[model samples]
Structures are given as C-alpha cells and as structure tokens.
Target: MKDIFAKDSSGEMVSPHEPGYDALIADIFATIKTATEMNTGYRTPEEVHEYMERILGKELDATTTVLPPLYIDYGKPVTIGRGCFIQQCCTFFGRGGITIGNDVFIGPKVNLITINHDPNPENRSATYGRPILIEDKVWIGINSTILPGVRIGYGAIVGAGSVVTKDVPAMTVVAGNPARVVRKITTPGQQ
Candidate 1:
C-alpha cells in the first residue's frame, strides 16, 4: 500500500518503507552526530548564518532568518512552512518527524526534540523516535522544549523555558517545565 505522507518524485503518495529508507536514516544519523558536536565558537551573526547554510545544505529564506549559532539535529524528516522565524541557539532534534506550520515564531534557545532513548543500557544504544507537530500561528518562547509525540495546536503560546511533554490544546497559553495551560487565547489579535 502507498503511504500518504511519503513523497515521490512528483510529490505524490509513495511507500514510506521504500528502498531509500535505510540510506536516509544512515545519512541523518551521521549528520546528527556532526551537528551535536559543532561549536558556534563566538562567531558573528553573519558568519554563523553562512556556516549554517553550508551545514544544512539548503539556502535559508530571506524572511525566515535564523540567528547565529543555531544547532539542529534532524535525524528524520522536518518540514518548516513559509514565513517562519526561528531564533538563535535553537536545537531541533527530529528523530521522529517534525512538522511546523506557517507563520510560526520560535524564540531563541528553543528545542524541538522528537526522540527518546530507552532507559535500559542495552536498548539505550538502539534508536527510537516519535513525531512532533506544531500547527499554524503558534508562538514558542525562548528555551522551550517540545518533546516527543507532542502536538502543539493552532494559535497556542508556549512561555519561555517551558518543557512540553504532552499535547497543547488549540488557542491556549502554556508555561512551566512539563508545560501546563495558563489561559486560553480569546482573540487572534491579542498577544
């Protein structure tokens, strides 16, 4: 059966477990290690941006600017929609799939992680992953981490330094480690 999420040459449905899966996984793992070990080393913003462009192997959009020293380890596929802004020193560890919708604003030092290692010493060496989804118009504050299997719904606001381990309901504001709902957003225009 074909997988709806899998992309073909024409961007149509394809098998998710196609022949290229293993190679893709290997490549991602190798790149992940390199990304984890990289040192920003006090470079200026312009230099850092240039470095990231080379490391990521894609040109960053003019509108979607990443400040200096952005560290992302995407072990799996990650899709970032248009007009998104990701700040400096952010880490996106996408072992599982990570999907960020349009008009999303991510503050500095934010971490979007999508995998968890096993506690058992033997299994710990093996790899595991989960999916992370962030819908449109969401604002994730500085130093916040969205963990594995998390879905931050549309128009939600995550406060600074929060750790998200669960689903964030739509139009809500959440804060704290293991982030909880603080309030609901009543108006779109309101901050």
Candidate 2:
C-alpha cells in the first residue's frame, strides 16, 4: 500500500512516523495562527490580499480578490494564478497541492480538498493526495466541492453543489454528485 502512494523519500506514507512530519505539523499550526489573525476581523480587500499572500508565500495579482475567512492547511503546495477571485469561507487542504489558474472564480463556501485518506481503517490516519487543477476562465459554483486529483479544464463551468470526482473537459458544464457533463459550451466566432 505504501509503495503505491508514498510521497516521501523513505517510500513510506506521511504519518507520525514519517520524515518531515514534525515540520508539516509546525507549518499547519503556523497556518492556523495566520488564519486566526486574518479571519477574525473585518479586513479591507488590500489587507485580505496581503494576508493571503503571506499565507500562500506567493504574491497574488492586483486584480485578484479574495474574501476573508479563507482556510488552508500548508501554503507550500498551493499555487494561485493571476486575476483569480476566491470567495469567502473557502477551505483548501493543500497537503497535496492545488493549482488555480488565471481568471478563475471560486464561489462562496467552496472546498478544495487535496487530502485523500487511506481507505483502510487501520491506516485511516495516513493520507495520500493528488493535485486539484483549476484551469483559466473556469467558474466554480457556490458550495461546490472539488475532490482531489481532478482537473477542471479551461472555460468549464461547475454547477452549484456539485461533487466533482473526475476531470472536466474544457468548455463543458458539470453538475451533480460525482459530477457529470451537463452541457458543452460553444465559443463565439467559432462553429
């Protein structure tokens, strides 16, 4: 089981026993501290962006806007692109990784979870993950949950409250639990 999903050098899973676990824990706690500071009070847009940049360890574009009460585990594996807008109360479990491209709009209360717990009860505490990729110009509807390992392609529209478990094709609309393709989009000036 470990060989199939090991993320560390030891060919072992990430748990209390693995290398870098202590530092990972420390980073999580630090993120918690920053989240407490950033989420507590009413902050201006610029302030919000500032704090988010600090948390993400990367500068966000000036045009990009993010509301407060945003949550994350470790910021090391998260990369958000330019001109993105992340709504309030979005939680990112970025232990694996999350890549958000330019001009993406993530709706309120959206959860981008990258942690996939070992299904075996004996090893449930151990986690393996895959990156969640949101391509440019994509719109994720309110309350949607983007599961680990799915790529939302460019110009795709994820319907509200959908649970996306697979890659969405570009210019397509997806909805429902284990989201299915509902429609295909046609761009102007093209057939």
Candidate 3:
C-alpha cells in the first residue's frame, strides 16, 4: 500500500489531490496545534518534552534540550535521539523524514528541509520526499540550511550560515553558501 504523505520509504510524489489527502491534512492541523502550544509561551524543559512527544507521536529521548519557538512540518516522520541541544527558531520540514542521532547540537535558526516540489510548472503542486540524516556528535551552526537528502557524518561541524547540499564527510568542518569542506579534525589523543 502506498502512503499518501511523503515519507522516506517512498520516492513517490505527493499532491494535495491524492486519495488520502484528508488524513494528511488532519496530521498537518494536529501538528500545528501542538506546535502552537509548545512555541508560544515560557515552557520549562519538562513541559517542552511533553509537548514534543505529543507532536511527534513518540517518546523523545531523555536529556534532549529544546528551546522554544521551534517549527516543524509533519513531526511523525522525524526522530530525535537523546542528549540533543536544539536552540531556538529552528524549522524542520520533516515530510520526507529526519533522523537526528544522539548528542547532536543544532544551533539557532537552523532549517532542515526534506521536501522539494516538482520543477515542472504543471506538476508544481506535487512534492517528493528525501530523508535527512544527522549522525551522532555532529554540530550544525546557526542559520544553516540543510537541504533534502543530506547525510551529515559523525563528529562533523558545520560552520554558521551554511547551505549544505551534499553529504558531509565525518570529522570535518564545512562552511559557505554551498558548504564545502574546510578542514578535518584529528580525534583527541590521536595526533
């Protein structure tokens, strides 16, 4: 059976005219409800966790600290691991699914976009899903934009204000509009 909503499992294009469109719209509204409540006020860490769980429909790992004013599109396709520190004003378009590994640090105003619309004018209403993966111990800097289908490797660091379009190699530093590799760091005690 085909899932109407854009998820990582399928590369099929999703349009508002699909058969299961009503279910998709329901999820969108539900996510908006939870996101509004969670982002509006001075919610404590515990409260934030609770709201996040409701939004995602799953248990958020312990020790994951998320500041208020976060935005997400379709939270069910997203998975956040333990011990992640997500700063304020981050936007996640998880329609294509997002897998964030443990101990990751995402700086403020970061945007993780997982869906892209078809370029053809007549099919512009249709969108395709491509998952985004962030491995453990990675740090994404402030105002960075990670595009669809990007896999950030472990222990990597993304410099502030970057636009990542491709897979980032492990243990390296990347920055710039297109985000090129700047340097590779040696593990402590190795050199």
Candidate 4:
C-alpha cells in the first residue's frame, strides 16, 4: 500500500506520521525553541542575530531586524530579504516555505500559516501545504493572519488585525476578516 500523501519529487506535504516526518519536526522544534528561549535573556540585537543565524543555518542580512520571541516551525524553509523588520512575537509555520521580500515591514504578533490538515475527519492527520510569497515593500500590520498560499503583492498594506485569506494586489489596502480591499495607496507624485 502506497502512501498517497507522500511528497513526490516536487516537494509537497506528506502525512505527519510518515517515516522521518516526526524526526524532522522534532529537530526543528528543539532547535527553534532553544534559540528563542535563549534569546529572551539576551540584551543586545547582535546576540539575537547570531543566535538566529545558528538556528537557521544562514546569516540574516545585516540590515534586517527581527525582535525577540519569534516562533517558527521550521527555519530552513523561511527566507527573509534585506532590510526587513519583523517585530516581536511573530509566528511562522514555514514547513510549506515562506518567502519574504526586501524592505518589508511586519508588525508585532502577526501569524503566517502555511500548512493545513485534510478536511476529511477520517484522514485528518494528512496534511497539505503551500508556499507564501510576500513581495517587496509590503507592510503587514499588527495581529494579522496570512493564510496558506497567499501572495501579498509589492507595496500592499494589510491593515491591523486582518485575516488575509487570499492574494492582495499591489498598492492595495485591505482590512477585516477575509480581508477586502479598502483602497488603493497612491505613491508620491502619482496624481
């Protein structure tokens, strides 16, 4: 009997109980939890940066600033571009991969969730995942939740406390649950 949900060559989500899946999750959790816990007592940003680099196995850009208390399921699949500012208490479920572009501003307590379980009750443990793309210069406000497979376009602004379940077009401002476009933001001299 073959496992239907097993990831093919194309890299997709497999059953959570599949061989090696639990081990991988456990490793990620151990590393991230230790780093985050250690980071809480560090008084300097440089210490946090070094700790995050060790946990992620990659050095973040010098200009990037991520406040402490950040949570991530797997740091390997997460990418942060240059000059991005991620405030404290942000959580990322990056097993499905999260790509954040340069100069992005993420307010505190935002959640970027990239994986979801099968809707069927009998196979609820089976999971599906999608990559989230946050384009350059986007501003995601405080307490927002960006759901799986969402692509937030360049220069868009997601209002505070919004639940973004779909793609947001460039330069648009969206708010509320199942976020709808409130208005288009005009760049300077765009009259």
Candidate 5:
C-alpha cells in the first residue's frame, strides 16, 4: 500500500503508506466524481461538516466548520482559525501551507492552491510552493481561487469566481481573475 502522507523529492508531501491510505484515496476520488455528477442543489452545512470529518483524518476545530464535500489534500499543513466557515466543495491543495484567519467565511467551491509544477516538462518534476494567507474576517465568494503566495488582507471580500493572484489590501472587495479592488469593506456591519 502507498503511504498516504509521503514527502516528495522537493520535501513537499505526496501520498505515503498508511493503513487508511486506500480508503482515503478512494473516498477522495469518489467525492470528486459525485460532485461532478450533482445536478445543482445546495448541501446543508452540517452535512458538509460530517463528510469532512469522515474523509479527513483529523478533527477540525469546533469553531472551524467546513461545508460538505470539501476536497483537501491532507498531506500538508493547513490551519483554520476560530469561527471560520468553509463552504462546500472547496479544494485546499495544501502542499505548502494554507492559513485561514478567524471569522473568515469561504464560499462554496473555492480553491486555494499553494503549489505549482514547472511549465517546462523537463523541470516539471521539481515542485515549488508558496503559502496562502487569508486574514481575519475575510469572506471569499463561491468558486474563487486563491493562488500561491497570496495574502488576502483583513476584512477583505473576494467576489464569486475570482482568481486572486496578488496581495489584497485590507478592507477591500476584489473581483475577477487576478482580482482587482472594486470597493472597500468599511464598517463592521458592511462586512
């Protein structure tokens, strides 16, 4: 059996040997397949949490809740803050590091990708990654992607289906690929 948490040559983690390796791998593949087959419908938050608890080896913090069918590669380190809510089907490929701050609400189908392979096929085997940081009280809309080396500032709001490629300033609202600031999240009530 393959290790479910093996470290790659670059010191990044890949699947390694574990008793639960087969089960976890099978479950992850099944979830992805099931998500693709779903005809549009909303899943309850509680259901999502239960699913995550089943698929992931570790228990999430009580204040850090994830909506069902979240796909996270558990080989790397990921930290969620208190009162954080992660929506359904979010993919956190945490080969580097992913940090979600307190009171952050991540919308459904969000992707936080921390590592990337080289474009040149010859060098592609070498893996490189950067950390993704989301500050306190940030709300990421549905289907958004936070790319490597990104830092979403405190109180920032990322719009639906946006791709964040750079650092977002504090209290701003950004949208679109390589997200741009459109507004500032000013008041506590506004955010």
Candidate 6:
C-alpha cells in the first residue's frame, strides 16, 4: 500500500485508480461512521470525548469541547487546539489537513472542506487536497463554508452563512458568498 501522505507539486493527490486508495477510503468511512454513531449514542461528556479522541487519533485538550454529531472524513488529518469550542453538526473534510488553533469557536453546521476534484471532467475522480489553517482566537459563524486551501488568520470572524473562498486577514469580519471583509474588529482588551 502506498503512503497516503505522499505529496506532489499540487499537494496531496488521491486517485481512485491508485493502489490502496479504495481500502483507505473504506477504512476512513468506517471509522468516521462509528465515531459519529458513538457521538450520538453517548450521553456523558467523557464518553463523547473518548469517541472523539478515537476519531481524531489524538487527545483533545481538557479545555476543548466538541459537541456531538460532528462529521469528519479522514479524522487523522484533523487537529484541534486548546480551549476551542466546536458546535454540533460541523463537518471536516481533512484529506489534506485541518489545523484549528487555541481559543477558537466554530459555530454549528460549519463545513471546512480541504479537498476538491480535478477540473477536467475526464479526471474528475482525481482528488487534490490542501491544508486549512484556522489560527488562534478565530470565530466561525453558523453555516459558513470554508473552502479548500484557505488560511483564516488570528482573531478573524467569519459571519453566518458565508462561503469563504480566500484567505481572511487577522481581526477582520467577513460575510457573504465568496466572502469579503465587511469590517475590521478590535480585539478584546485593546484600546
């Protein structure tokens, strides 16, 4: 089996024709399905945390909280930082990678997608992935979709229902489809 981490000029590439691709996809789907089920079935915070940890393949910070019904593809590529709060029904497509920094708040139903298909119809099944970096103290509003390869900077706020297709500068507030900066925000404790 070829290493899924194999990189190329366009970042991570996974094709249906590639060796181990089918098996890898199957394993990822099964893991995510079981984790999702466990998340809903478990009532206690500890139980939910345990299931989430298994999905992530890492321990979440004690101060971090992820609500149930979270969705992820290839959870191994996702990393959440300390003191973060992830609301329910959020989906992460981390085939590339997803890194969420400390003290972040992600509202419900947000989708962070890091993978896209080739533009050519003949090669549509060929997938390319890019890493998403959400820096410290960011707030992502409900129903926002952060597209592939976006770097959301520190302390930025993504407004509700926005489709973010580009990089967001630090301390800025952005909204709308193909999101644009609406205003700059002043950090708390700043004069």
What residue runs in model 6 are displaced by over 4 Å at the alpha carbon? 7-10, 188-191
Candidate 1: clashing pairs of residues: none
Per-prediction TM-score to the true structure, in the order listed: 0.71, 0.91, 0.95, 0.90, 0.70, 0.92
CA shift of 7, model 2, Å: 3.3
lDDT of 5 by residue, 63-173 (tens): 677655656664225677789987777888765678888999999999999878767776664555678899999999999999988999999999999999999999899
Where model 3 places Cα greater than 4 Å from the true spot, the runs are 6-9
Model number with the top lDDT: 3
Tens digits of per-residue lDDT for model 4, 1-191: 33432351124546766776666667667777766674567547787778677666687898999897888767766789999999988998876778999999999999999888888888887777788999999999999999989999999999999999999999999999999999999978997
lDDT of each: 0.72, 0.85, 0.91, 0.84, 0.72, 0.87
Highest TM-score among the candidates is held by which one?
3
Order by TM-score, highest first? 3, 6, 2, 4, 1, 5
Once model 5 is optimally superposed onto the true structure by TM-score, how far is the C-alpha of residue 161 displaced, in angstroms? 1.0
For model 6, residues 1-191, the per-residue Cα lDDT tens digits are 33754642236667788776777778678778867686666557787778878888899888998887888877877899999999988988887789999999999999999989989999898888888999999999999999999999999999999999999999999999989999999867977
lDDT of model 4, residue 114: 86
Worst 10 residues of 2 by lDDT: 3-12
Overall local distance difference test of candidate 1: 0.72
Model 2 residue pairs with clashes: none
| Candidate achieving higher lDDT, 4 or 5 | 4
TM-score of 2: 0.91
lDDT score of model 5?
A: 0.72
Per-residue lDDT, model 1, residue 143, is 90
User: For candidate 4, what is the TM-score?
Assistant: 0.90
After the best TM-score superposition of candidate 5, give how far the Cα of residue 53 lies from its true spot, in angstroms. Answer: 6.9
